[model samples]
Target chain A: MKLHSLMLAAGLAATASMGMAEKIKVGMITTLSGGGAGLGIDVRDGFLLAVKGNDDIELVIEDDQRKPEIAVQLADKMIQSEKVDVMTGIIWSNLAMAVVPAATAQGKFYVSPNAGPSALAGKGCHPNYFNVAWQNDAYHEAAGKWASENGVGKVVVMAPNYPAGKDAITGFKRFFTGEIADEVYTKLGQQDYAAEIAQIRASGADMVYYFLPGGMGISFMKQYAGSGADVQVMGPAFSFDQGILGAIGDAALGVKNTAHWSKDLDVPGNADFVAAFQAEYGRLPSVYAAQGFDTGLLLASAAAKADVADADAFRAALKEADFQSVRGEFSFGANNHPVQTIYVREVVKEGDVVTNKLLGAAAENHSDAYAADCKM
Target chain B: MSTLLLIEQVLNGLQFGVMLFLMAAGLTLIFGVMGLINLAHGSLYMVGAFAAAATAAATGSFVLALVAALIAAAAAGAIVELTVIRRLYDRDHLDQVLATFALILVFSEGTRWIFGSFPLYLDVPAALAGPVTLPGGIEYPAYRLLIIGMGLAVAAGLFLLISRTRIGIQIRAGEADREMIGALGVDISKLYTLVFALGAALAGLAGALVGAIQSVQVGMGEPVLILAFVVIVIGGIGSIKGAFVGALLVGLTDTLGGVLLPEFFALFTEASSAKLIGASVASMAIYILMAGVLIFKPTGLFGGQT
Candidate 1:
């Protein structure tokens, strides 16, 4: 009986030692299957690529399925069950809003790979939350400024009728003080834009600004081209980025878009990123990929600065905003959102690839307008 | 609006209506004949799209990809019918709904397992790549025109097949009285398989055609499937003519609502407020239409006898 008891005690000590050596857990939730899968997949791949040689972090992946309820549920499970030290990779603002507060409430470090909802950027900002991407409305605000500077009068604005859509229109209107001919909102996943195009033609708008992303953007662009309207069309990066280039093809040519990072940006970090991503995926890295890669690097930098096993320490380290992103030098604001550049770009046919080329840099390390509301 | 723009919008509405019809026809047929609501029908559409994309990527032939899509979707339908659907024929609607919902989970996860969660894209064929100038100086995509033509051809073929053939009589009889027809020596099981495969084939064709224009990935079918359900519901479930009319109504209403609502609001409110209100109302137009229809005609416009 004595020998059996001694064996049991030794077994418990061995198991405890093994537990101490286990990798630090990180939870990553993103939309991995659905219409938004392209962007989410790229972000997931970029994050994985960033952690290629890192042996300390163990990633636990979950798919939110592009639903806010599911995201909140998953965030809860990640925090209470999985007991992850940090959480990351939310693609949509609605989903981000659902998960960010929950993760932060649990005192887990939450790093956003893509979404930067205005609410979290301002009054709702949490110390445990950190966005590696720019504010959701920042790019559109830059586009509005560019349109004003270029003398684009009588501009008609359109976006899918949703919270994000409203944010986009408000962002555009922030800087453009021209004659607003019309503002139109369509269903969030609308596949047709014929009637909208007809209205744009009838309204006599000189240019049309829109903020449709992913599959909706492709469908809208195709129908817009079919409408035979000659009015200039423009949007932010999400409307005509690398993901939709293959689907949109020549239809996207000459379309103006605004974004933070383009494939052709001349910085050495950008060039290296573009080359590495192209070499790895055989396609140019999109702003989504760049943001995701930066997110991974950001996490790694924070981990290096503090003991990742100590969750509170890691969270504080990330909040300190010490990392180099491919979008050039950027730092987190008090609201846990990045102050980043936004560029106005034009879609052009270069060789066989249709891509967005930088037309002009519109805003430099610009913070969101809602930053004032965020008392973080 | 300019004449050209009006003409283009009309064509767009027609094109959208055609796509919705492709989805609705199969749903109405299955519901009419089987008396079962199969929510997993969208899973078949996703399967067809992924199959087409994978085959096309491998062979570099759009024609082969389309053929593969049809075969794959049909095969999947038949297998699902034999394993899961056959048992649910006599069950209540609640059971059928639950079973099909489970099937959706299986199909979606199975698809993800095979495709590794990446979107597969199919390219538009060179034969129908560019925009063609139509009458009234309106430019339309040749591929879209092809889709519209294919939809019409299928509609005509379905009408002929239902009216002019011996199997058509069996199908009609089966729809009217299943037990009596089965007792009369017709093999009902084989007939059920045939109908399911046919419905799956139609859905597959729609998926393959649309896959060229959009990203082919998991869960691509859910939205269209819901819209198709709305079409069939408005058209009267199990009625092909109703499906066609319902699809067109929805297509036009949804397309025009987005454009007209904001302008109407602009008359009374600021431009931004008008847009917000108009868009919100436009998004709810179809649901409002559905509710209005249900209030007056509880059985749907052409739903034979509720």
Candidate 2:
């Protein structure tokens, strides 16, 4: 028995010494097979592309179907069954809120690739939680600032009636010190926007700012074009992303949107990312994809610098954000969310394909308003 | 809100109602004749939209796209009725619901597999694109006016077919006494298939018309399906007339409620808070109307002894 124990001890010591290259398991809960699947797919593709040759990171992706309950269940499974050291890849803010706090409380590192809800960015923030993406209100605030700068008066703002939707309008209102023509809150998954378009036409607004994301945005833009409402339409990049711009077609052309990253951003790693993403996925990458790529780089950098088992060291490394981001110079704020420049992009047709052309920074080196409330 | 805006909203409500009527007409007919609840009817609608989108992309012909939508949706419906729906005809409502719900999953996943999750573009044809000014200086999309006209024409044609044709006699007979119609040698299964196909075609037509304005994506049918169900329930299970009235009422309530409620609440609250309150309440307006209809007429407006 003593001889056998000595042999086992020697084997364990050898394994421990060889554990420097240990794989970090990341569980991604994203909408993969539903209406919102396009965003999640881009995020997954970009993340996978960034860590393509690096075998040190193992990603287990689950389709949340954009459901909060399903996201919670998946987060539980990731933490308990899969025993993932890191969790990420949630696109919707509600799903992020459903999964993030619980995962962080359980001593698991939660890295947000897309969603950055106000609650998580504020007092509910955890040291183990890091958001590579901007806060939920960042892009909307950028649009507001852009609109205010351009002397856009009497703007009609609209969004779906959900947490992020409320956040979007609130953010826009914060920086837009103009006469509000009207504010419309629509159903979460409503396709038809006839009623809303009629209201916009009659409201006599110089510009219409809407935050309808995914298919909702596509529907709204198409209908708005057909209505010939004679109002300038604007929104954040979520509505004009590369994944959806083609679907929106000419209706989206010349429309201004705000985002932290664009395909045409004159950043160090952005050109390579754009080329690599197009080569890999046969399409241009969206801001979500850029965020996903950054998240992968962030995790990889932390893993290379410090062992994930050492929570304090891993957290500190993640905070450093030592990796090169596609969005140019990127860093985390007091709230653990991105402090980055948000660019204004106009939807333009580039050689038969609809894509965004960078119109310059809407808000440079901006941080979230909620950072003051985050203690950690 | 100005009088012109109200009138425009009414027109928008009418267009929405007419679209719902197309969907409800099929659903009511299937439930009336088959006594089988096919939850996959929405899948047929999705099939139609996808068919239109694909054909439009390939041919760039709006008329051809619409024709393809009709044919594809009818063919899909016929196939589903022949292969799976017929089996559930004699089963209980719960079983039919279970089977059809499974078909929804299959259709959703299958469509996603074929067309991908990205929404396909299907814009209104140039001739129908852009708004047309009305008598009261109110401008409305010409395409919406077309939808309203087409819906009315379809309703009239359906009425004529049901009240003044041989198949209509058989259908009414089948609805009244299925076994008796079969005993009288009326090829009941064939009739069922024809009715199912017809219903599916109507749904597909609605899908095509709406797809021009909406995103043609997977799971687009389900939301409209719920509203269609409310329409059929409020109209009466098997009554086409009931479906028409119910659809119009629901559409007006939903559209106008969304517009007017916020204005009404704005009187009592701040503009932003009023919008929030009005929108939340407006979403519930249709259900409230449905409940009111149910309270007054449990069997539905036209649902009574045949």
**Model 2 pairs whose backbones collide:** none
Question: Model 2, which residues run further than 4 Å from truth?
Answer: A1-21
In angstroms, how far off is B153's CA in candidate 2? Answer: 0.9
lDDT of 1 by residue, A1-376 (tens): 0001001101212232233333457788888775587788788777776665665566778777788998888888878887888898899988887778877887778889899888898889888888888888888899899889888988988888888998998899998989888777778777656577667777899999999888778777765665567899999888888877766778789998988888777765778778788787877778889888888888777766677667677767787767667877688877878887888889999898888888878988788887788775
lDDT over C-alpha atoms for residue B277 of model 1: 87
| Model 1: interface root-mean-square deviation in Å | 3.0
Per-residue lDDT of model 2, residues A202-239, tens digit only? 88899999999888999999999989787998999999
lDDT of 1 by residue, B1-306 (tens): 466766666677787888889888888888999998989889888888889988987998999999999999999999999999999999999999999988988888788789765455576777776678887766677888988898889888988888889788888888888899999999999999998988888898889888777657677788889989999999899888889888888877777676667778889998778878888898888888888887887778888886
Residues B45-151, candidate 2: write the lDDT tens digits.
Answer: 99999999999999999999999999999999999999999999889999999999999989998999999978898999999898998897888899999999999
Give the clashing residue pairs of candidate 1, or none.
Answer: A122-A374
Chain B TM-score (model 1 vs. true structure): 0.97
CA shift of B94, model 1, Å: 2.1
